[model samples]
Target: MLKVLNAGNETLYNNVSFNIKGQEIYANSLILICAAPYFEEIFVESSTNFNQTYNDIEPDSFRVFLRWLYGESLSQAMQNYEKEENRDIFFQICKDLLLASSKFNISTIKELIEYKLVTYIHDDLVYDNLEKVIELANEYELDDLFKYCEGLKDVIKDEADEPENSNIRVTKNNSRPSIINNLKLRFFKFRFFLKTRTEPGHKFKVIN
Candidate 1:
């Protein structure tokens, strides 16, 4: 099982080397080719001489990719970095994974990252966060995610544009009160009229 040969057990099955950030990471050539077609060109059939330096991608992102390639569930693999302290780094890794998956042409990782990013939407969703995700969605051709983020951006924009005094009633001449507020105002007026009516036969007519 690929899971048994993961991480620290590098000496067990590794045949190809990747130099990421001056750190040497090793993996099985067969596994890489089988997992992503991008590696098929790098490692020829049964050839052992393979070493590549990757300067564009972060080491953490590459590690996550390898773990997924080595039979780890994407969710389970991300659990280690899901802490509050690691939240920022984890988000960056997910973003990097999108690029890495794109370069490798791996749809599974891309789909998982899309779903993971979508989970970020909520009542407290931030505009900047949504903006970044939306940009990534468009760049990566994630149409569904792009649409969702675009809609959420509009919703958040509308909410931000709302007046701070939105809950406060406007002047009667300026605007109509909300239904509940109108009903409460009518009840208060009727109560005042009744109170006045009891005073010395006061002629208080309840006007509609």
Candidate 2:
């Protein structure tokens, strides 16, 4: 329907066109009216303006929703395009879709973003953005990702505080003592090592 509608199929009079964030798109009222009650009211009150552009959501993210309405799956494609480049932008748009979905009470879109966020816990989800993502999870009541993020605090801590090296050295002196006696005397010493490297502008304390 989207492909046909986008191709300017004037025969489909049952559908309505929209300029969402300056990008033109449209969908069948029968399909979107039920999913979004706001559309239903717009049609009911005959208040929809075909020329007016709706700026409620971002253009690209709104395109995602329009595609989803046309029977295309969103979450699977997002997971398949997993890349490190522009991670923040992708997640930020996810947040936008989440907000837009929430506004219309579209649980499917909301759930799609939740699943993506849960997957992010294993990827670039780090301490820098942890608080923001956790806030979003809490806002949406995404218990799964919330608990996952909580568990990662410990995991990230372990990653940061891990010992760089731990070695044990052993020495034997036959004149001083037999091998067995030397073993009993505790000649082996354990050493703990840690890396001193830290990123610039990161908080570091020095002792005099």
Candidate 3:
């Protein structure tokens, strides 16, 4: 038998146990759908289903959905999923998560989106995702993301204008001393040179 509890401060699953497919499982919420052998048990604060259609049915999709419902961070949602060799699903999940996060008022998830998009600025593929990133940043008033995009724009323009085989090097040039100091040093050097050049026969007394 499956037992469920509503939102409350008490720990519902403490020492309470059940059997799923002959394996002992203890959780807060258990949804045992008819004709389904596996049990879906999850511990969450709140959950709701939207009428939106999903193209790909990946775990990340469900994770993002949960994040949107609970206002959880992107990092927390990603932690719930197991790591996969191909991250295509993960990337799409991140994009969807950002959209959902922005739709709601999830500040931490929005921050994660900004961090990821800003890091992509140094990549050549950033141009492909530039529009979406810029739109999100602008909508959320992300100053750092906007600045990073501006810097990437300048870099792309510079690279386009520069010729191949042209090595651009940056060097620091030291400037001379002030004109007044230079004149003072020159006068002092001239006086020293004149005194040293003159012999004892033509003795000259130095005056300040």
Output the number of the TM-score-best candidate: 1
Question: Which residue pairs in candidate 3 have backbone atoms (N, alpha carbon, C) closer than 3 angstroms, thus clashing?
Answer: none
Model 2 alpha-carbon drift over 4 Å, by segment: 8-15, 47-53, 76-81, 165-208
Clashing pairs in 1: none
lDDT, model 1, position 91 = 78
Better of 1 and 3 by lDDT: 1
Clashing pairs in 2: none
lDDT of 3 by residue, 1-208 (tens): 1222222214554232333224333323332211111212212222332112434334445444443333334445465442444344545565666665554334444555554444332222235555656776676687766665665555445544667413422111213233224333433453354345433221111111
Local distance difference test, per candidate?
Answer: 0.64, 0.55, 0.41
- In order of appearance, the predictions have TM-scores of 0.71, 0.64, 0.41
Q: What's the lDDT of the predicted structure labeled candidate 1?
A: 0.64
What does candidate 2's lDDT look like per residue over 1-208, in tens digits?
5556455435564357768777766666666665566666666667554333667777667666666655556653254345666576677678877877777666656655655665554444356566777899899887755766676555446444645312211122223233224233221110010011212221211201
Clashes of 3: 0
Minimal lDDT window, size 10, model 3: 33-42
